[model samples]
Target: MKSTHFLFLLGLLAACNSQPKDKEKETEAKAEQPASHEPTVNCYQYATATDTVRLTLVHVGDNINGMLIYQLKEKDRNVGSINGTMNGDILLADYTFKSEGTQSTRQVAFKKAGNAFIEGYGESAEVNGVEKFKNVDSIVFSSSMKLEEIPCK
Candidate 1:
């Protein structure tokens, strides 16, 4: 009887010791891994009373890269190719475009709203007798200038 009881105890210890290896194998089989491809692009468009703008953005882990096209009705306009970084709800980009048959670069920013975007307007200054927005962000966008998002074009 003593030998029988000792064999049963030994078998119980062996079973308990082997359970953890099985658990480790299960965990290894179920571990989650990161995706192998980039996400899709997101596009948005808006039209003001006198101008139309379109934006296309690709997001990768909170970073953003996109394009902006601004065209005025029957007037000189800019179609800028922009690359920017996004932080929270704001995107700041350097715009390079041709306007009035001349090429120029400017820094622009956009704030995301619900199904729309609020543009950041800075203070105006005179540079070589031309008024330009400088040090902007003072004027929050009113309801009228809030750009409504249309289908991607």
Candidate 2:
């Protein structure tokens, strides 16, 4: 009877010990795992970009409308052009790019935050001899501005 009880206890210990090895195998499988190659809904949510920008910053008091164009003037740029519709701060342009005189179009995105854009890219240009994207935190077009459409062509 003593030996029977001892054997039963030993069997219980062996069963318990096997549980940990099973768990370790599971853990190792997870640890040596692969990252997610599948796309998730959150990934699409973050990528849902706004189509246009409405200014809410500096002295764009009146309704001014036009297009924006960025050129690779003194650098190595592949393309350039930012032609869009403007309603005060809101711009809806068909941005284009011409590198080596080839043209392609992309929608320009913009948003106004405080004195400047907290997000979005607008065509900062030499408006009236001053670059638009320079020290300006807002767009206040005056007489000196010479609107430069992009792609330089």
Candidate 3:
């Protein structure tokens, strides 16, 4: 029985570790240096999702648009909002805000693409704090949500 249990645990670990080659970077947390100055540019943002994260997108006819909210955690927990265009399940947004004292911008790009599926990556910081968006860089969420359907805008 003990051997069976150990085998099961090992299998579980193996299963969890076995991810596709394209999504290796999604699981790691990202941190950027804090700044305390004004931003030279308006806002910066980026995301690399294809068709995962269905919940974050609202489709509208052939053209889809939605709002992306990035919560700044370190500075003042400030929330940054961006307007994104949706292609199938992928949504893209670029927004910025001030944290401690520095201004930073983040880009939202499509990670995956499909109907009702939305997958992508995005991170941002203000003058004092950093707020990393969840699901933006999750590898598993990218693959499964490719088949999920989201509401049409």
Q: Cα RMSD to native, each candidate? A: 6.0, 14.9, 21.7
lDDT of each: 0.71, 0.42, 0.43
Candidate 1: lDDT over CA atoms?
0.71
Candidate 2 vs candidate 3, lDDT winner: 3
Candidate 1 — number of clashing residue pairs? 1
Model 2 steric clash total: 13
- lDDT tens per residue, model 2, 37-150: 442110000111322222221122232223333332365344343443345455444455565676655554454323333234445655453334533345343312222212
Off by over 4 Å in 3: 1-67, 71-78, 110-119, 122-153
TM-score of each: 0.61, 0.30, 0.29
Off by over 4 Å in 2: 37-153
Model 2: lDDT of residue 124: 68
- Residues 8-83, model 1: lDDT tens digits: 9999999999999999988887776555558557777767677777777777765666677777689777776776
Q: Candidate 2, after superposition: displacement of residue 6 in Å?
A: 0.6
Error of 2 at 62 (Å): 43
Candidate 1 TM-score over all chains jointly:
0.61
